[model samples]
Target chain A: MVDREKLYQAILTGDAKSARALTEEALKESVDPKELLDKTLIPAMDEVGRLFETNEYFVPELLISARAMKSALELIKPLLAEKGAEPAGRVAIGTVKGDLHDIGKNLVAAMLEGGGFEVVDLGVDVSPEAFVTAAKDKGASIIALSALLTTTMPAMKKVVAALEEAGIRERVKVMIGGAPITQRYADEIGADGYSDNASGAVALARSLAAKVPAAA
Target chain B: MPVSQPTIPRLEEFLFGHARCPVTCGNHLEIGAGTVIPEVNFTLQAIEICPENWADIREQYSLMIEDLCRRAVELEVPGILFEFETLPPMTVNPAWGLEITEILSETIDRFHQSHGLRAALRLTPNDTRDHRRPPRMRSGPFWEGMVEFLHKAPHAGADLLAIESTGGKEVSDEGLMNADLKKVVFALGVLAPRDMEYLWGEILSACEGTDTVPSGDTACGFANTAMVLADRNMLPKVFAAVIRVASVPRDLVAYRVGARGPSKDCAYEGPYLKALAGVPISMEGRTAACAHLSHVGNIAQAVCDCWSNESVQKVRLLSADAPTVSLEQLAYDCRLMNVAGQSREDARKLRDWLVESDSALDPQAYVLRPDVVLRIASEIAREPTPYLQTRRAARAALREINRAFEEGRLRIPDRERRWLERLAKEAEELPDREEDLIAECLPETSRETFLPEEYGLS
Candidate 1:
């Protein structure tokens, strides 16, 4: 039997070496890879994310744990894929046109991936047209728009309008997030949802994904 | 689903220019702490100083109007649009009002004389203000002042006048909507149908509420909000509105990237850098501008500290003292570092060469050399306390060297480990003076005052 508790501890402590070794050992012992991921890795990462959101852990700690989780996932990704695994949902994300800030978008992308979503990142200063194109091309169910400037907030509306113009407004749910974006703004823009933080974004994406016909 | 064609070409054109020449493109400006005033002759003076190389100039309304007038008189440059950011009252000391008007008038006078520049001013207001200060006043007084100043400019003056809406601290949708943007436009006294047409829509759109509010502190947040509101046509009247507020330009409007008030803790960097690099400014000026921001300076120093070569170290040391150091010594030091070979023998040869060629090897260089400087300072210093202080200073010096190394800004041998060992030894001895140093170096902020109970160091 594998010491799943120890594995969990390793993940929380960001002990990549120990976590990797223990996870591999568990696999060798006939432990299901999915069980190790679901019961041990994911839960540990979730706690890390919570600690991060609560300010109990700073960037350095979060980065280390994220790195550890990434390494561990690399080893498990193959097995998961071999079993015909799919992400929770597909998301197309970007900072709106004219605004070039990316940290918030990047954090949300990380969290979305962590939450089992395939994220197609359209880098900063992305236009409304780019967002629509990326969503349609990637077959994404959710479009996450981020803006950190009051000046660029209008670009978000333009992007929403572009989506409507492209006839994909109904096909994809639009979720907005950023330092300047708010629930009120989301409502004003007629966006599907708005979240203030990465954790909330993931949860929101997951909830919205469930409502999508294709995702469902 | 049909994929929409990207608007990248428009963005690139707006950003880079039709020719796509980086040097020919307009760049953003960092408006240092200054005042904008509306005056005629002053406006002409401003146009004379306007950097001809720049295409887009972001400034406050007062400055933008002045720049426009100046461009008109001096360069004959037409259609020179200026984005003016409106700031909250709290951010501006009322005492600086006159100064602001002075700067603005001078900028406009120059534009009027040149007949070369057309002008558009975007207003960005600061989102933070102390309620205790005074009741909120919209653009009325400012427009009146601007109109009085523009009346003095020559007829058929600079082309455009556009008002930009900005986010302010503690400003709510209701507060903005209640503020009379129309009255402000009336004060501008630019009753020409074209001017009125431009101003009314912007002001009204700015007055409309948006789902998103200002991020409370970041300039980018206010700028973003303004953009969103403008797009929704919720922004108050445009007869006074200068431009369609957008997040890209707003992120670039700041004295420094992360400075207090009117800057979002997030955003600004990516867009600003992209816009700046796309401009035609000289590399030296660009480097200086980049270093002017604390964040950029810190990153540069961090990179320098990580890797440094002897040549790099020499350049840094020389540059640090260039204002005070002799030119002959600077040249000699440069030559010494440029020489090949690294060993005790090489060091000795360099020392001999220095003695033979120059009166004395620059003491500062020797004082900064990882092995030699520490060894000498340690010998002269009486106790570990001074030694630690000296070590800290040396670390600061070496930090520059390290950055030069990593940036390939200079060429030097990799000696980070040896330097780290020295730093660690110095850190070990730091306990004796740690409290004193912290007291001297760490300034108190509102959040942490270094209370005795917090550190128990008392």
Candidate 2:
């Protein structure tokens, strides 16, 4: 059996090689990949995320741990696929039109992915029509819109309207975020949710995904 | 043993007194705000130095000035041209003009002594015409105060004093008609031939008088009246006043002209560029100028603007590349370009091409910072998939390491601690890559190239 303690240590220390080696060794010993993933990798990452959110860990540490988790995941993915393990959910995201800033959107996207969501990121200056099209095409359960400029805030409302007009507004929850965007503005625009930062976005996405019907 | 002061190399030679163009048109002088110092953004560069914020100013001002002087010297640019202004302290009333002048005189002397740099001081008297809460410049009192201030300027170590014709309800036409340009010029001409000459002669009896540029208004817009003087062979006096203060080499006094607006203004655009081209002077415009010409977006426009200008042979382009470019590469290229000026054109072209080609890989193209990977991971954590599954797994590992460090499970060394300190300082202002920080912490010889996988970015 793989040493779960050592695997956890490797994850915590951001040791990619050790994590991969231990994960592969466990797989060879016929240990369930999902069990190792859920117990060791997920828990390890959850701790990392908590630390990051608390300001205890910074970008470098976060990046290193992410790299280690990636290597370990590569070793276990085929086995998980064979076992028919499902992902958390699907999401569509972009920066609103006329706004070229994307750091906030990118951070949310990274955090969402770290939370185990499949994100279709339509890059900056994406029109409302483009957001709706991407949502429909990807069958995304959530649509996250971002705008950094006060000038570009109107673009977010236009995008939400476009989604409503497409008759897919009810199908996907729209979440708006950015530096200048506030919860009051989000409510005023009739958005399903609003998050201030990347970590909050992940938590919001998880809650939104839980509300979605399994059949849909 | 006394600590030795660092020697500042005279990168650019001052020609003392020479005339490149005997007859020159009026040029636009940006005053009120400071000169756009080298390296920093235009807005920050032009901010007024406030004594109230002196602590912050003291932290960066010396370094900023040193950098600016070094760049000017290295680029072999002519002497610095600056518009000097003093705001009455919040605690003091407007009647303390003498005190304000004394404070300003002390500050200017200290600035010059510390940097071994002198500046042309254009003194604008307070406008008190409006009966508002704070009285502005009253035309008569203003000129009288300036003349008094000029009498004491030489003793305070000021090189030259020019009258600023900026204020009043009449100065709104964007032309010299409303401004006090003619009055200031006449005053200089009248006094310069008599009392001013005696005062200046006494002030600089040890040095040559040929280096001075005669006093004139800090012209707003393309001063059409000043152009008329240039046509009449009277520009030599004004140029002499400038030379007295700055001692600029004749070949290096680049006359820059541009429209005054926060953004692009069509009405001013045509006239401004036309005036610049007519004056046989260099033109300085923002990103809009290049964006309009190149029809490109973002940094590409800025790069093209600075590079396309034949006059900007010694250009310093800011934020030219996305943060995704390796820090090591960026720093290396910056130093390399400074050493060898020939690579500017090629570097700009390469940068433009890189932006175009890397548009797709830009996962968070909406944001300019390079921390998009973090966002992607967070999203994937909540909604998993085959495509994002790998990314989520990678982010998890990164988070784990972060957690360990936070919990004090991992101990960082002293050398690495210093590196982290520097990184923390830099990151407070700007977001940067962790791998880059790690590399920076390492010894110069031991520093390794950052791999995307090493930081879970891949």
Query: Which candidate leads the pack in TM-score?
Result: 1
Candidate 2 per-residue C-alpha lDDT over B149-249 given as tens digits, one digit per residue, 9 for 90 to 100: 54454344333333323221121111122122222222222111222223333223322233222232222212222222222222221221111111101
Stretches off by above 4 angstroms in model 2 are B1-418, B421-458
Q: What is the lDDT of residue B146 in candidate 1?
A: 36
DockQ, cand. 2: 0.01
Query: Could you give the CAPRI-style class of model 1?
Result: incorrect
Please write out the lDDT profile of model 2 over residues A1-216, one tens digit for every residue: 668989887877779899889988998998888888878887887777777676555443555676687788877777777888865678889988756445457657766765667789887778899988888787888889998655467778888899899988777888999866899999998898898766678789888888776654
Which regions in candidate 1 have their CA more than 4 angstroms from the true location?
Answer: B1-458
Question: Candidate 2 chain A vs. true chain A: TM-score?
Answer: 0.87
